[model samples]
Target: MDLHFGDSEPTDEERAAVDALLGPPESAWEGADRSEEDLRWARGGRAARDRRELLLPGLHAINDRIGWISAGALGYLCRRLTVPPAEAYGVATFYAMFSVAPRPATVLHVCTDLACTAAGADALCAGIEARLGPGSGVGVERSPCLGLCERAPAALAIRAGDPVRTAVSAPATAQAAVLAASAPDSAPEEPPAQRAVPQAGDPSLILLRRVGVVDPASLDDYRAHGGYTALRRAFALGPAGVIREVSDSGLVGRGGAAFPTGRKWQATASQPDRPHHLVCNADESEPGTFKDRVIMEGDPYALVEAMTIAGYAIGAHRGLIYLRGEYPRALQRLEHAIAQARARGLLGDDVLGQGYAFDIEIRRGAGAYICGEETALFNSIEGYRGEPRSKPPFPVEKGLFGRPTVENNVETLVNVLPILTQGAEAYAAIGTEHSTGPKLFCVSGSVARPGVYEVPFGVTLGELLALAGVRPGLRAVLLGGAAGGFVRPDETDIPLTFEGTRRAGTTLGSGVVMAFDGTVPLPRLLLRIAEFFRDESCGQCVPCRVGTVRQQEALQRIVERTGAAAAADIALLREVGRALRDASICGLGQTAWNAVESAVDRLGAYE
Candidate 1:
């Protein structure tokens, strides 16, 4: 944890790990052997300084090969990237996944978030911890959602080595978790991504039609399944024409904001700024939200194609997909899909021989939820702490290395495919007038068939739950994730539209629909939600950093009290929640109290 580089040196293994990503150092200034010429003149100016953006990737190069970061390895990475030791340490420590201290070679991440808890994650964690005793060469760390809510009580085992080994145990038993931790390579292969799509082969499905039916590993399979048709149409229409079609289709962002996609593209495209950039926000860290994960895993080609179209439309030659680090399967599938596309002339310079040069780079987020915000995501990609920047001049005006940038999440980008292929009028007609196009819902918790569902926007909450096979004794439902509001079971009549959810005092945040029964205590659930926000806060702003802690503390006190006994703490929660919502820098703090407030007002958790 020293702020300055020390005499300690990285081991041979550590040096090779870093070198693999950064290549050999050019001179003694970059951790190379000091030479006669190095003593006379100094190296390091704009070029060396510009490489600061490689700091995160260099840290990953170390952590991915070794179990945890060491002071020596951190110093070496900082030296190579021309970053200060203190700043590099700060960035490395900002994420939950990276460890700057020594630890076992294998670590087991047990999901303790809402859906997993509903499926008994606490007991599962206890059993796993008891099974993997100290000196067992395995460490167990409780994690937030891993985006595997459908098969709750999920555990991810990662073993550090030359090439890191990983395994997933979902709906996990203690024995399976321990085995995965001890020997990840020996664990059974994970189930196909399509297993998470209940209505995979249904003809009615739009976003999910190719999920269970196609061979995800084969790009040819994707092409045969009507993939790339949208991109070709985009090429024909040209940038302006493509934007017009999207505008006419009325497609909005699926990442809860519901911002008009065409308008965003138009703004970014029209920007006089040179070298505009495009970014795909694939970091789906919200608890109980896994629809993006399913799309990237099952239909990887769709996202690649969509990003290509988006980049072309915005006149951006480069795109980046900020993928979450926990999604090993999704990452693998997407990597393969991207390489295939690049090799086949679908990506890289002069894509599709259309004279439009564009390509994408995948940046893995090191377990920071705030990075899901567009500005924070930009900061993360730029190798800074994943903190949100103040808006306006907005992203379209100045973003991503101070250039105009267009950013959209996985689902929003994928929606572009349908909009371009099906014609604007037809696509707009699928859903209601305002909430146009089909939506993907991540349905889990107390449902017999929990999975990601693709349905038109106008469907009622009751209708969606019925399709998911809601279990008996349904007491409440969380319309969104932790940041979203809760609705009583009786409120299922509420329509699942953007306007409808807004009118009903709820949000279709990332299309999360988690059902809960009486067996699960609402008070305890609310406490966990509060804890997630508190832990995920970046501590950059006072309102969020302080308000989240106060919110959690008040909820902790009220969880066991009822009626008048809890009245004081409930009021405290409201006061603190209001401060957070009004003064917080980003959405994380702004909506941190939504689910808790809803639980108190609508579900009568205490009274």
Candidate 2:
């Protein structure tokens, strides 16, 4: 396919033709050849007036027809749906599944969003470049959303063969096919080992079985296996009961702050307003936190149920899922699930025929780490700079067009359905007093098995590390993400509870447990993190923006002047940490020092 750029504007007739071709009203069901039976089943009169409304089904049908959506086809869609060119462009850009550009012979989409970036995604990108060479047709694109934001730095490779067409006046002879088939069975069948029953404790086998990565075909399949039971139970008990049960369960936000989820809901519910909103914060950008991605990708219905339940609890008529653009697959899954829910009359007005109305719209973010912050996220949803605003008038007081909004992280919302379905006491009984229920810990780094794992909150770090298959003679554990702390080898014996982690001079921020064997040098690791902060700081605040660069230079000097006297830089590092922590305007700047401070205390010898 040839790519082109045109400078001249189209004439009035040309513009009208383009508009007529692209507008949804004009071509509602223009190309669709659905049978009367199919149309009846879908309750179709005409196709949807807003093609954007039909986006999920349209993309799915397109993918089903062709292995991938060609650029020309997408352009055709732009005209057929009557969708504004910009809006159509936005939709195509927002979804990872639709490639507006030409499909490369081989496309490697690497995850460079926050989580993957933290887990050495940059190094992996460099490695790919080194192996594949730069500017090669082997396309390596940094995808904003693969819906596996938590998996960070994950990638999907797609290979395309040149399109071949054979002009046929008549069908080919069966004799030619028989002769070709008789030539060879060169393609290998399943290996002998495949015949053997797979053993337990194999990481790959466990991931396939337990992770629930594949999409469920029907709501019945989902329901038969503990799907919307939570929603059913939630509706039966009513909204107040849900609020009370969640409160009693003592569930905290899994995003970062660990604030009480029920309390946030209550604050939003108390406000007697017209359009209170419930937002599921699926922008899981924290380094080392893939638990949210797992939930969104594996069991999206749980989130849908949870959000619907939250809407009921808060009298919210509309809900929004502010998903990061980096997670393309997650976004696609969510979009599909939302459409399915709407089709079943579970999402729109009079949900379950209960007279309560709640509809969800998925909004994509443009790769901003600050948008992970609740306030910053709110601004992004409103189409502004994704920078944090002051929090006295928290989102609960004024959010999303000056309405009360409850924004819970993806995992936190996922837990809500389970808590409401099961008794609060059941959840409360699982974890420590202050920290209740199971926490999904994302284990990464040098561990033999690195992935998201669920464990009771009170479990010890040593136990989690052992479960993660940490190597013997491990150096240190980086608990949480780049914003979290470094725990010494001895500190692994400490319990993994919230309070326990705090007592050990670290917050169990986002439950990211990264194990490091003794291979990588401590100074280099610190420098890498420092440099990351230096590059990522939004420059909104003086301390974080300027201080991170200063810290990087100081650490670089210490590394260069490595000797017994390099210990003097330790005090300077501590000072910088304290200043940045104290003077920063937002959480990004404020918490940026936590890792550095904890690392200095734990690994001063390296400095």
Candidate 3:
């Protein structure tokens, strides 16, 4: 029996979408069955040649335009790009977003990750699903963090007519939440994509000053509010001087590793190679990390300007923003920002008439959280399965297509603008000596005001909790996202800096602070954390794959009150976590046990 019984054929609209990418598959394709030009166009023609390395982008084009990747579309794309069908399918299926089966025109992705779960995402999901019913034109799928921790119980709706997904910030009210997508596309008065937050003003805040104040869609508005001031500064200093300033600022990667930014740029710039690359790690998939999404949706030009400066300093002509598939609003805003920048002679060739050419291309990830890793991100961008590579030929010396590439996350890159404009010394003066500059912390869960907060590096957890409206009777806090550790109520006095958290035997991982009140069940939360690791593990290394599974099983046994004592299960979990940390290839495996280990040992969740 054909399981795909009544799947619909690709609509004319869908075909038109793919045609835009492959450039009107010659008339010969209809008669020759795509055989005559298969090799020539796939490997030789302009359509396939330059874009073959952009396999991930090609898939994104199809999915975004058509709502799903069909079997026929995949085959046609494989022939056009010269990628084997098996390889293409593997890449597509590996991601959570790329649906092989047909889907409704509008798909509602409900957040079910830790942050959302705490905010009653499970109830929200169940309510929406019950209302919609199965086989409805509107479909619902539980998603990992959609990067809207601040607006807990959020969802992203992918509509046919819209260019990007519609982000539903607060969807817990009623079944009206599902109405977000059920409405016909034509009934709209203005395109949702054109909608922008009205700009307001607050000069007191540094990183977030422009967030709510600027009309994110207006390039003119951005310019009026002192935008591009950093780029002009960069051109004056030249690439070398800009690198020196950033290095002096003592800024580090905000993706939790704290690697020096200026050192990375200097290494990439000093590389004796041509055609280097600058990759903006916009694949912000950490469960509670939504600062990048807010920045992109609110102040996108900052990232564009930052990428341009990065390219100039690294001596690269091309820049790629590897955006997460889940962040449709960020992707749409960035797409507009890049286009606007190019039209204004800011992004494309000979930028600022300085004789240095640089451009940025946005590539949407399929749905692999592991792709958040630098190496895995590179592999995904190159159209391969998202997997991490062993280190020692770090990204600075060798990255993204065997050329020296400097990859930084959204927060890390945006910080560059302030560092260069404010002067490294001034910027460095604000934060702790080792952890310089302002940081964006994602504060969510059980708080009155759950959102992204900007603060200097050394702010204490107690202070942050107060700002976020911590509920009384607090039991503990999940200091980081799933990959981070937990902190007991007594630990609120601990500073929130990377070093401070480490000294307290936990990590300020990915700037995620998920607050938990006494009402929440800690054991269940730990089990979910374990389950996330098990599901997200790429299974590349045996330790991570098997260890994550074992860890989850042990946690499950404890949660179910299995014959095994809580102490025995906790001990078994630690043993497995240690193995994963010691033997795993990438951070996915190495840090898989952080949340579970912390909850059991520090928070006494097992008891």
Candidate whose lDDT is highest: 1
In the range 1-607, model 2's lDDT, one tens digit per residue, is 3332223333333233333434422222343335665554543233333434444334333432343454445444543553444554554454344454555445555655443554566676676666666555566665432434323445654343222111110011222212212221221221221111112233433212223423433555556656777788888888888999999999999887989989999998998865888888887766666677666766677778889999999989888888765555577678888899899998998898888888998876645666788887776665344567876888888887778989898878878866876689988988899999878787776666666777788989988888767878777788878789988888888888889988988888888887766666677667767776776576767888888988888888887886665667766777888889888878888887787777777766463
Candidate order, TM-score descending: 1, 3, 2
Q: What does the lDDT come to for candidate 2?
A: 0.66
Q: What TM-score, over all chains together, does every model reach?
A: 0.99, 0.74, 0.92
What overall lDDT, based on C-alpha atoms, would model 1 receive against the true structure? 0.92
The lDDT-based order of candidates, best leading, equals: 1, 3, 2
| Residue 564 of model 1, lDDT score | 79
Error of 2 at 36 (Å): 44
Give the runs in model 1 whose Cα sits over 4 Å from its true position. Answer: 192-194
User: Candidate 3 regions off by >4 Å?
Assistant: 1-14, 26-50, 160-169, 184-202
- In order of listing, the candidates' clash counts read 0, 23, 2
Candidate 1, RMSD to the unseen true structure: 1.2
| Error in Å for residue 508 of model 3 | 1.1
Residues 1-607 of candidate 3 have per-residue lDDT tens digits of 2223134345566666666766765533321245655646533455554566767766777787777888777766765675766888878888988787888768888888887787788888888888888778887878887877776677766765426445464534436457776653422232121122111243656787788778889999999988999999999999999999999999899998889888999999999977799999998888888888888988999999999999999899999999988776687789999999999899777788888788999888867889999999999888889999989899888899988999999999999888877898999998898889888888888887777788888989999889778989888888778998888888899987888988999998789888988877888888888888888888899999899999989889899894458678788888898999999999999999988878877887766
Write the number of the candidate with greater lDDT, choosing between 1 and 3: 1
In the order shown, the candidates' Cα RMSDs to the true structure are 1.2, 10.5, 3.9
| C-alpha lDDT score of every prediction, in listed order | 0.92, 0.66, 0.81
Residues 1-607 of candidate 1: C-alpha lDDT, one tens digit per residue: 5578669789888999999998998889988999998999878645768988788888888888998999999988888888888988889999999999999888899999999999999999889978877788898999999999999989999999989999999879999999888878788866765559999789888889998889888999999989899999999999999999999999999998999999999999999989999999999999999989898988999999999999999999999999999999899999999999999999998899999999889989999999999999999999899999998889999999999999999999999998898899999999899999999999999999999999998999999999999999999999889999999988999999999999999999999999999999888999999999999999999999999999988888887667675898988889999999999999999999999889889998888
